[model samples]
Target: MSAPIQLRPDETFILNVGPQHPATHGVLRVKMQMDGEYIVKSETVLGYVHRMHEKMGENRTYAQFLPNLSRLDYLGALGYTHGHVLAIERAAGIEVPERAEYIRAITVELNRVASHLFWFGAFVMDLGGFSPLMYAIQDREHILDMLEAVTGARLTYCYYRFGGLYNDVDDNFIEAAKRFIPRMRKSLKKYDALVTGNIIFRKRLEGIAPVSAEMCRKYGATGPVARGSGINFDVRKNEPYSVYPEFDFDIPVYHECDSLARYRVRMDEMEQSLRIIEQGLEKLPDGPFMAEKKPKTIKLPVGDYYQAVETARGSFGIRIVSDGDKNAYRLKLRSPTYSNMHLFDEACEGMLIMDALAFMGSLDLVIPEIDR
Candidate 1:
């Protein structure tokens, strides 16, 4: 927690929630001005775990910075890696193989599912429902195992290469993924029963911290945060990348604009991610996973190039300025968590302290992503 701030002579005072508290969710510190149990205003203090990822991109070679992408959002690392690789490929005119596109899409979607599963567990745990955390983690373990079999890492995965994956997945990995879909569907049914339909859970979330469509726009929120407020903007649908256009999937949206709506959006998104994964597997083609003609030293023309990918959290983007060199001249990462977390100050105003915490949880923050 941060040191206490001085307050006026009135009963109103500042309360330091965390730089280390579990409720702040990942090295986040929130200074809340409170009147009794209600919050007057709140400010989020970041930079606790800043790694300067964009600076690393400038110093390292195009290929050397691949691992740094995973470190930003460890839960959905593949999506970050995808954005970085796609940016480099686009800038250098590297043509990725068709099979590699399918593999990238498949692995990224699986990572999305794992990320949402972990979020479901952690969010429920935040709300005082402990058992669902265990159930969610139990199901998430299967995805981790499946991804580990192919990527060789469970958590901070650096699986994708500039024009393909580090290696191609085998038949056994495909079989395991095929089995996982049906099992996960069954688990979702149980989750709906145990958490969604519960009266206590519904009461805690239903009308709390309502976010309007206008608020989302002003704050630059995306993913479930924007979707919950009835915005139909998904990076996958709006700007098609990889093999996502080849697959059919619905972008889940909820008009309620409350915490429940955000929760519902993520829950429904897991199903859509599963659909994409299944279609990618069914349409798997026979070809080399890596491009045969990639140069050893990647040098881009003197220009700016940008690539965007829809990660589990939201729109993740990489913008690179190249000077026809092996390394980037200027690199910037547009992380979704940073934009989403920007809404907290306005959103939490006049809310109960408990409700404010719940609202923060609904935003699905990963602080390192923000601090980066």
Candidate 2:
């Protein structure tokens, strides 16, 4: 690892949180300059799990890179996959059918819920609440079952294709999603009582790590991180990709900007995602799942094209440069986690180490997403 941050001989000392601490979450190392329990400064050291996904994109054919999207953020794999597919489709001038678009949106929103649920459990566990992790996992398992019935993988899903989806979702998938919405609503009520109202939970989070709207802009943060700060920008609502424009859903925002506000934003977002899924199901059209006509050898036009989609974390964008080649001339992934993580060094200053770690958890980072 990089040498621990240097300071005066005895006044401040460096502590390495992880390249493998549970709280650091997924092979991350944070070198903190600590004056006893309080952190004077911190630097997040990344790249332990860098798989060079962007380099893989340049080496692989357009279709070959579809599967790599999942490895970046396994928890919210579909969102990344959706961005990749949409980028390629737009570059190649392929039109996705209405039914396929609805299916993509439904599945992606379900994946978003799953991601947030996982985060809820993990974050609670980090704060020493063990029981809620079990509850969160139990609820998330149902989502996995629903996704597995169609995608054939619980995590690291590679279901979305260039023009549409690899396969069409059936009535069983639709019915299960319909059933899941109400069941999840009940679970949300339980979480509100069990976790949100808990005095200890609030004490730990309520006034900690206050991220301002200006900080969000400076760091290019999006998703709940931005929403919690009262900057109303969601790629789905603001950019309007796929069939999301047809749905009626509100982007939840809280001006508190503390960890609790971030937590509340995610909890409220699960409800909004359910609303999107329900509307998407109701309006799902009857048509081919994939485009009837597509190029045998997929190639982008001689220009650059970009597409952005809102994931469970924040806005994810894919930029592709092409000279009419089957493979990308340059493929760049703009992951939200990388931008969100940028604020950690400045945000952690002057806070206790535990609070700083909790603040890190609130960002909902996926390490591979950043390492990529």
Candidate 3:
């Protein structure tokens, strides 16, 4: 009555990549059934870093849970912070100061740049290039210094508040950011010359792991992974929030649908983030950083609320169901890497194990985000 989709492999062996290794990125495991070097099928082993982040949100006050957002996608912590803060502010009917919004945009973009720079070095290292990681880390430190000065965090930042920021940015922070931009521009050029143009790097990723636009849509992917496959969707531009509408930047989309295309999307995005940061600094307004009359205790009405933000990996969304309580009746977190990583099981099948690893690197996954 029905035919089998394909013949089963006569012989195959299961292999575990890691719960502790670089190939999976941050406590992730990949289970691959291999027929020689080719993968017969693959399954991603998640929950290695699960922290019950959503449940924590339901138990704590709206303000108390802000710090937990950073722990989800530590590399792009501010992006997750932005979403949660926006959700709480909207629910409680708070008005954020324009200056605070501008500052939020600037810091988040800087964080995005830092996240991409880390990905660039790490992804290349996965493919056997080590020199680039040192350069990338050195450049990334400059960003961390500036962010740490203002947000007081090297990583896992909890800088945003319900109505605004925890504190205002000083002139020194603005000056540091402005000076940092041109220097970063030079660094991006160097990265392109050293990594992007290298023949070996090109050969490794140029046509490896080609994920199509339709496949990206089917899998509900976003950020560079989807953009690499020719899908042009970004929450910042598609659905403008905060001060993003005032800034000018273009979404980087590549039709190549290969590992190289994903790599290029992130590289180009760092440049776009710099553009957003530069514009934000120029248009910096003089106003209070926090709402003068921020509610001392936020208690949302009985309803369901949702907010979305474009993180370094992809779109991170927060949903809350409240029954007129200080603590949410139910809280849900939608992390982009979760959706992006799910596609790996299907995409890696029938490909060489080495190539499958290359494809996984292309995803730019941060496993804690998925595990959450």
Candidate 4:
């Protein structure tokens, strides 16, 4: 008979992960308890980049706060803008015209594609492959050019209005988007060849960060994290906001529940977004872009309104508690990355430091979004 080994209860070591770690990709602090390189316990402390967005929204009128949403999630500014604007519209009972809605949907989907392209690059980069990042960004630049032409901005687009879009899509803008899609499709094959099939990347990412569907549900995980775990819930599909149902595209789902699965989901989703954009552009009607009487001064009735949109990372929800005043009484942004990051402790438990970075990359977290 072999004797059982006794271990001390106080045997634990702390490993600080960031407010500066490359894996974190932004300002974030994670205190991890380790048994050697494998994490045993972890706690993430955020707010390093907190700008008090909710509080800021309280003082700004609905239209005035549009630009601020772009600042919260800089990587996916359009998505943030969509969430904020849609929330206000829903609360104020503002109906955007069909043409404007189509434009909004197209732009939002373009932004979603751009965000995923950047993530595809960053995720591969985190896994120690730099080539894919550049390749992915190459495709992303085309969309940025198209967006800049219409929005007068590249990254932070203040182009969404209360009842509709800030401006209409011109002939040149439509032509440019039409020309770009086919080329973009061809380039995706190159991206796949560069990283997806690489033995090293596959080995590193496959079967890692196994987040179960039950775990995702318990933590309120949304977007790719939940979808990666075989959860079929998508705010775009489920809630059906902003002209999404008019387009035909399959919501990509993966049963692997690992980093690789999430990667595949995002890649496939980019294709689906392109399809939606094509359909939106085709079905787009001609009309006034913005509502003529959208009210320069906006006020909502005293009530609470919650709106959720499917962002590049996940579902972003804005909760507004209005007091029938120009300023919001209270505002809360439920960013998807914040919840998606919660599962790190469990997913990273037995992972090495390198594996931990890979897991973090797979979550596709935007630090400001998480910290905010």
lDDT digits (tens) for residues 124-158 of candidate 3: 99989999999999989998999999888999899
Question: TM-score of each candidate?
Answer: 0.97, 0.97, 0.96, 0.95
- Could you tell me the lDDT of residue 261 within candidate 4? 93
Q: Per-residue lDDT of 1-372 in model 4, one digit per residue for the tens?
A: 998875476587898988898888898988988876778878888899988888888888877888888887877889989998899888888888889889988998899999999998888888778888887788889899999999999998999889888778899999989998898888888788778899999999899878999999888899989999999989999999988889999999999999899999998998999999899889998888888767678899999999999999899999999989998999899999989999887777777877788888889889888877
For model 4, the superposed segments whose C-alpha errors exceed 4 Å read 1-12
Candidate 1 C-alpha error for residue 148, in Å: 0.9
Instruction: Give each prediction's root-mean-square deviation over alpha carbons.
Output: 3.5, 3.8, 4.8, 3.8
Model 1: residue 45 alpha-carbon error in angstroms: 0.6
Give the alpha carbon lDDT tens digit for every residue of 1-372 in model 1. 998876455678899999998887899999998998889888888899998988998999989998888988888899999999999888888899999999899999889999999999999899899999899899889989999998999988888887787899999999999999999999999999899998988888999999899988988899999999999989999999888889999999999999999999999999999999999999999899899999888899999999998999999989999998999999999999999999889888999988888888899988888888
lDDT of each: 0.91, 0.92, 0.91, 0.88
Per-residue lDDT tens digits of candidate 2, residues 177-236? 899999999999999999999998888899999999999999999999999999999999
Model 2 TM = 0.97
Please list all clashing residue pairs in model 3, or write none if there are none: none
Q: Which numbered prediction scores highest in lDDT against the true structure?
A: 2
Off-target runs (Cα >4 Å) in candidate 3 are 1-9
Report the C-alpha displacement of residue 371, candidate 2, in angstroms.
0.4
